[model samples]
Target: MTQDLFDPFAPVPETPAKSGNTPEFSVSDLSNALKNTVEDAFSFVRVRGEISGFKRASSGHMYLALKDDKAVLDGVCWRGQAGKLGLVPEDGMEVIVTGRLTTFPGRSKYQIVIETMEVAGEGALLKLLEERKKKLAGEGLFDADRKKPIPFLPDVIGIVTSPTGAVIRDIMHRLRDRFPRRVLLWPVLVQGNGAAEQVAEAVRGFNDLLPYGHIPRPDVLIVARGGGSLEDLWAFNEEVVARAVAESDIPVISAVGHETDTTLIDFVSDLRAPTPTGAAEKAVPVRGDLIGQIEENGLRLSQAVRRLGVEKKTALESLARGLGDPKRMLEERNQMLDNWADRLPRSAVNVVSQARARLNETSARLVSPREQLSEKRGRLENAAVRLDGAMKSALQMQQARLDRASAGLRPSDAKRDVDRAGKQIMDLGARMGAAVKNTLTREAEGLARYDRLLESYSYRNVLKRGFAVVRDGAGNLVEKSADIVTGQGYDLEMGDGVTRVTAGDATTEPASTPTAPTSGGARDGDDMPVDAVASSKPETVSKPKAVKKKDPQPKDDDRQGSLL
Candidate 1:
């Protein structure tokens, strides 16, 4: 297979042998050599082509093929550089990329590592702007349903434009002449690099202002700028600025330039005022015109009221004329009143007679106040006398009972009771003392017995009674003859001390008088003489046999002594 120049794994081109020897190169060395050469030659090159296969990866790096009608070149913009381009690359966009040419060894291809990309000219910028416009329009930012109605007379007006430009002056002067309102001016750059971001941020900042904050929120917004060329006015055409205007909670008036100027923001805003001055006019009604209209309305209302009142008065007079003369009507009313007056005194006399009869009958039915008081007084006296007699009887009974109870509770009787209680207390104290003593004695006897039991089981006591403990070569207690190997050394601990000795075979002759060992001093691993074994029969070995030498174990100085 043919090797590509940029591939790191590609085989190096072979060189013809010169006198049976030629310089050598590795695949990686050749790839590096080619990469350096191309990078050095095109370190600061600029190429113009139409962008194709454009995409931004999740890592923010932008990749595209910069192609013409006949050829194509691979291009890449790193994340940082791509962000600073100020324009998102799209298919068919003609752009000029300035960067160094570099080879990707793994891919076996060369690509331009772009540091910056820009539209080739105004045409390319317009194409890019148009693509972006379509995208945002598809998202419904420019829909009429998203548009908010501008306030007819807002309490406060917020203007977003360059603070030092004529846009602000025109907007402010127009507002003052028309109708003065509180103006909140947000200062921002209207052109050049990062202008779109600043303008979008300004729009969001105004919207973020709290409705009841220390700084009052604007009732309506006026995004204005002075006249400029398409490049100078590109900030307003940015999708960021357009979307910002679309999402603003307050109504927005887009006034970017002269009457002929247009931008994406103009379509997205709630109202498109042709100029900054027009925006101000749209934000508020003219003060003089409003006052004039008010006066005209007032005049019309007053004239209508006068016409209505005059018509109603004329109608009333016509109705009054239809009635009879006033003097004859008054004479008839006077005659009727005189007749009523003549009958009123006789009716009053009859009512007075009826009321007098009712009073007399009521007076006969009701008892006199003096008689009622006299009866209540008689009842009170009877109750008082009965109460006095009852009190006397109660006092006599209480005194007799108290005397009887006191007669039994005398000083002598109190002494007798106290003496009896003292005798009982003495007896109880003596019996309690005897019981506590007996309990202590029984507990002491039990404790003594437990102490004796513990002492009887003590290792020292058992050792003192002519016994020795044997630990095998593994330092474990030898509980059976099977646990001991005949030739293995073991530790023998007695009441006085421990000694190392080898186990003797379990063979024995008839019991004979004890004698000294036949071997010299019974060296470790030496078998004890058959006459010394106390048993008669030899034990058969069942377990696997191993003879291990035991290391010397240190013992406390007090525990190191010969057995008596």
Candidate 2:
């Protein structure tokens, strides 16, 4: 396999320095010498193109490449000048690169030591992410302290995903098979260009509801999709999504793509799941174990109840055995009863006299309540009559007004007015058509401008600069430095996904790099499962069945690298 000219890991592979065969020394040594001389001569050089494979290095530097369709230049930014870059770079994006062209004498490779990088798409989403990071970081949303804990026993769980995908189905299935608790779903796009924004909105929507709304607030939010290439999953990397996840009052679980793929949301989320199915598992309570435990607890309770009954019976028997004889106790009780019975007649006489007086008092009091009740009834009847009269009067007034209005408008005049209005309406309709056409024209121009901006400074331009994309199994773009945790695996879409690659960047960013499809931690293999987000997963789930499935699709499915 051919080695990468800028493989940071490999011993700088030997480059055949001087082209052509006729050489006194080997081409490798000549190439090395030429590389050194050129690098030494021009301490700096400036190039214009798009940015690709933009990455931040551990040494407080930036590493990326610049390119257009025709050519690409490997580049780097040192610690000092990297801070000066006014714009954050993105793959396939166009930009102006200013740097010192030099050769690493050790590797005999040519590269640019970057100074200033500016996007003709300047201050776009990448810059927006940096700004957002600062903003949210300031708000403690990204802080470890403020993150909500995922519910251990969520009474109800809400899922956000595409309605047709396996994500919802899987979630429903798992939830049913397990605890069979309530599983609520809010369907949304999990992939594609709009998926991130939709996902973010759905998350916010759940939080926005009052108690009596259609869907309950999710105890844990699961954003999910199947597996795909990095570009395919770019929607999850959007900063809007990342911030939404970070700022969510409910803990979020990211389940985009396969195990290897992770997005910005992963870093900001409470948890990261490998797949939609996995996300379902994470959000759901384990059914089998929970039910078994419940049953076990029930049995234990029954036993405890029996034991308590036995203990109570034994105590009652002991008290009964310790008690005095029934005959002696009966005699004492009879004597006490006789004395009280004799006094009872006198007490009864006094009580009877007092009761008689109270009865007379109660009879007198009854007259006022009866009279008051009658008066209230009379008032209610009067109120009803008044209400009826008011309603009739109002109805009559409205009828009179309508009659007057109609009377004033003679039929001829009304018809004439209607005709005039018709003519005016037609004229307005024609004008509205013209306005629509003009609006479309303006919008078309705006779209063209947007395309130009993209061409001048988007991820595509960056890729031309010899950068590569590392996608998770589900094809989501993982941009955050924090997302690429150890043990995470991914599929790389190099310049064309056509160009072969031999290595990956030694991920150094803080895993907060915001991109289109942001997410949480890494999971398992690149299993292109269906969306389980919208589907249900009760504890009674079946095994992974043999089911037909469409391959996971990317945002720009029709993309073939065309200029706008």
Per TM-score, the best of the predicted structures is 1
lDDT of 2 at 72: 74
Per-model TM values vs. the true structure:
0.50, 0.35
Q: Which tens-of-lDDT digit does each residue in 1-564 have in candidate 2?
A: 122333343243245446673225355655665665576567766688878898987888888888788987889888777644533466766677776787765675778888776555434445544555676667766677766778887776777778896667887777676667776677876654356667888888877765446766656778877777654565676667877787788888888888887666777888888877777677667767878989999999999999999999999999998996999999999999999999999999999999999999998777577889999999999999999999999999999999999778767877999999999999999999999999999999999999897665454433333233555555676554345444455554432442222222323322212211111111122122213211211100221211111112223423423311
Worst 10 residues of 1 by lDDT: 509-518
lDDT of each: 0.77, 0.65
Show pairs that collide, candidate 1: none
Cα lDDT tens digits for candidate 1, 532-554: 22221111122122212121222
Q: Native-vs-model 2 lDDT?
A: 0.65
RMSD of each: 31.4, 63.2
